[model samples]
Target: MAKKMLRSVLFACLGNICWSLIAEAAFRKLVTDQNVSDNWRIDSAATSTYDRGNPPDFRGQSCMKRHGTPMSHVAWWVTEEDFTTSDYILCMDESNLRDLKRKSNQVKNCKAKTELLGNYDPQKQLAIEDPYYGNDSDFEVVYQQCARCCRAFLEKAH
Candidate 1:
């Protein structure tokens, strides 16, 4: 049998405590559900240092649990190696895209293709908004969006 290709994806947002963490969880769940966890690596990171080492926002945690995609993740800032190592550096919004693009300029062998995670949304939503300043309702929206986009992303990756 031919060896399967292993792919790594790093989901990113301004603070790894919100949308990025949701994306990571959603993607992880999808891959697991598809029984392809061994073929892919999934993680999340931040574009800024504000929430480094912090766990996912409580609201997001509750939202994920409500949707059956419960997750826990510690925040970490994106590094040059993340850019050079990941096959896809999927992000939440324009600010994340801009920040990642700027950071990639500082790295010599950035192999990751940085793009909006929303680009994979079957519903055509353009951005996954940050829910830190909002309520549980906002976090619910983030979960909905991530679920849709992550499903599509995994389908394409397969």
Candidate 2:
């Protein structure tokens, strides 16, 4: 029997406090539920230095709790190594996608395929809006979107 190759994905957003963190937890849940958690590396990062070293937003945490999804991550800015080490770098929206693409260009031999996470949304919702300034209801919307996109992406990946 051959060993399975490890795949990796890094989720990104401006602050890494809301959208990306939600997506990371959602994707992690999907992979764990599918019994393939051992074959993948999952993480989330910020496109900028904003909120670096901080835990996810309180509302995002509450949202995940409500959905029964577990999340443990600190905000960190995306690095050049991420471009080379990850299989895919999925971001929340167009601005994030553009930031990731531009950063990838600066890294020599960047191998990650960066794109908007919403591209995998079955409902054709192409952007995961930032919910930092919104209330719990907004965070709920982010969770729903992440759940949908993560499930779709995991299905296509495996």
Candidate 3:
């Protein structure tokens, strides 16, 4: 018998309060539901320090609750260590992708492959827009997008 390798993933957005948090929660649910939670490491961070150390946005939290997804992540900014540690550095939109790429470039021998989480969307949606200032309905949009993209990504990963 051989031990399985564990893959790590870090999701990111501009502030880590909405889009990224939703994506992280969605991905976790997928992995857990598939009974592969032990095979992966998952977390999320912000490309900027805008909401560092804060809880996820209220509307995003409410949206997750409505969908029965659990999220308890405290906001944090992306670090050089993340570039080296995660196998995949997935982000919400173009701005996050750019920021992760730039930060990864600064780390010698960066190991993570940073990409837009929406790149895996079966519907070909290329960006997951931030819903920070939007209403609950906007948060619902983000949730739906994250669910679709995360499922696609997980299926491809396996």
Lowest lDDT block of 10, candidate 2: 65-74
lDDT of 1 by residue, 61-89 (tens): 88888878878888999999998989999
Candidate 1 vs candidate 3, lDDT winner: 1
Candidate 2 residues 1-158, lDDT tens each? 99999999999999988889999999998898889999999999999997999988888888898889978888999999999999999999999988888889899989999999999999999999999888999999988999999999988888
Candidate 3 residue pairs that clash = none
> Please, what are the lDDT tens digits per residue for candidate 3 over residues 1-158?
98889999999999888899999999998899999999999999999998889998989889999989988988999999998889999998888888888888899979998999999998898998888778999889988988999998988988
Tell me each candidate's TM-score.
0.96, 0.97, 0.97
Full ranking by lDDT: 2, 1, 3
Question: Residue 49 deviation, candidate 1, in Å?
Answer: 0.3
Q: In lDDT terms, which candidate is top?
A: 2
Error of 1 at 16 (Å): 0.6
TM-score, cand. 3 vs. native = 0.97
RMSD to the true structure for each prediction, in A, is: 0.9, 0.8, 0.8
Clash list (residue pairs), candidate 1:
none
Better of 2 and 3 by lDDT: 2
